[model samples]
Target: MADLRVLIVDDDFHVARLHATWVDAVPGFAALAPVGTAALALQAAHSLRPDLVLLDTYLPDTTGLELLRTIDTDAIMLTAASDPESVRTALRRGALGYLIKPFSADDLAAALRGYARYRRVLAGTGSLDQAGLDRARRALLGGADAPSSGGPSRSRSATETAVLEALAQGPGSARALLSAAEVAAVVGVSRATAQRYLAALAEDGAVEIQLRYGSTGRPEHRYGLSA
Candidate 1:
């Protein structure tokens, strides 16, 4: 598959460049040169036909949410606007993900990974089953909740099996749990990939997650085989 082209739409040139660098670091995304105004953004969206837009809430000519309404591309609101109204509006406008400004690169990567997962889950032709549709939507949350199709009939994918195997080889104490990075190292995959699978497993009741709180940010999740 071709790398998903991303148009950076932020007024700050330096911030846009920094975000572009971060986007480029991910495996399957490419960032176009950043644009500062809604006018340039519209022109680029028309001409470039990018697969996604990393949009800032504040722009020179218009609000990012308003611009989002006019653009015909997928978008993630990367903005400083943390007001409840702004967040709710972005969701109503079909923004794939919303990241508050000052977010870490890991935060953005997680959102992008979730969006990629969403695209993959919905890519095939024909009408989707309820489980399939639910899975695709949950992918927007990075699969934190997993697919709800439970029971003995529920089967694990090859990658999920690999993640489980990695967990088995990890620290063998009753309370021991491994982070996604540790599992990724063992499985020879990116942390983001490992995280996506691990989160699903955790949510499906196939694995257990231990939330380890640190001094800052969200608590780190560690995984163990469910007993």
Candidate 2:
């Protein structure tokens, strides 16, 4: 498929243009004409049908989160707003990626890479089963750490705590990648049990998985502390 088209929405035309430039520079993305208002953004999205949007949260006509819910495409929110509520709301409103203001080009590229991965998973052959769908969303949003309707979590269990501790300490070999099996042995649990904890740890941003390529066959999955 061709590169995903992007719409840049920010009140400052310069910033919007800059975002468009950034989007265009990414290998798998193309930017549409920058729009400086929410009304125009809505209109553009409806008419142009871009694959993704680069939304500015501080729109003069309306709040970005409010616009986000009504838009058809996924978004990577751009804003100077540093409040926790804004982050929560943006993610809740179907934002696949969130980029705080004054970010580098590299940062935007990383977010785009994530969104690309998310799309690739969805576009793959056959259909995604429930767990596969969940994993794909996780790939998009970075993790499942968003608070539930009940509000933020208060605590972690013993096993969860131990898993976090192990992940904190690097797996000790640059050549060898950590796995649930290793973590399970360390925690004195089964690999399946270790995976459950590891999944939580990954959601909480404590661990990151890397693919290990061998001389032949399929690549293996390995774990490590998040950078």
Candidate 3:
């Protein structure tokens, strides 16, 4: 594939710059421009016609979700809101993926790859039948199937389901998973309880845990659906 042009929109200048730097660092992408508001983003999109957009949920002038409705390019939502409803809303609004804030470069890379793959399938560059789409959707949802079954059969509780659903939105460490605390909060539980449920899911092969080490206090453990 050719290099993808990306425009990043975030109210935080630091974040927009950081995302632009990371996207440029990636091999097959060209970070076109980084804007700080929905109005500027729309203007840039119309003028630049970027291949993709990395947009934040909150903007000084308008909500990211609303901006998404008016845009015509492939987009990914980057936000601190990890709630299932928010994630679902973003996806329903035509976003290719939902990325929570504080994501690492590797996380961004993985999402880009997924978007690339999805684009390929949509463009007929890859073969994906109904079964394949179903499997991919299940995998995206972070659901595990039984050994002999062809579909997902849940053995987790409602809390575990909520945690898994949030994790499905993007990759994150246990600490970062707190971004999705609204899931547990909606169920009326503390963040600690939500963490415990995620930990349990990790232990049960319902999720995958990865240790991320950086210039920080302790190595952070991020989780995703077990593949």
lDDT of each: 0.81, 0.73, 0.69
TM per candidate comes to 0.66, 0.60, 0.57
Q: What lDDT tens digits, residue by residue, belong to model 3 across residues 88-202?
A: 8899999878889889986886666455444433555577789667644453234332221222354556667677766665435433343324445544667645544554455
The count of backbone overlaps in candidate 3 is 3
TM-score for model 3? 0.57
Model 3 deviation from native, Cα RMSD in Å: 14.2
Where does model 3 exceed 4 Å of error? 125-128, 131-227
Let me know the TM-score candidate 2 reaches against the reference structure.
0.60
lDDT of 1 by residue, 1-227 (tens): 56688999999999999898787655457789899999999999999999999999999789999998999899999999999999999999999889998999778877876787787787788899998888888878867333323432477667877888888878766446998789889899888678767655654677886667789754566789899
lDDT of 2: 0.73
lDDT of 3 at 94: 92
Residue 3 in model 3: shift from native, Å? 0.5
Ranking under lDDT, best-scoring first? Answer: 1, 2, 3
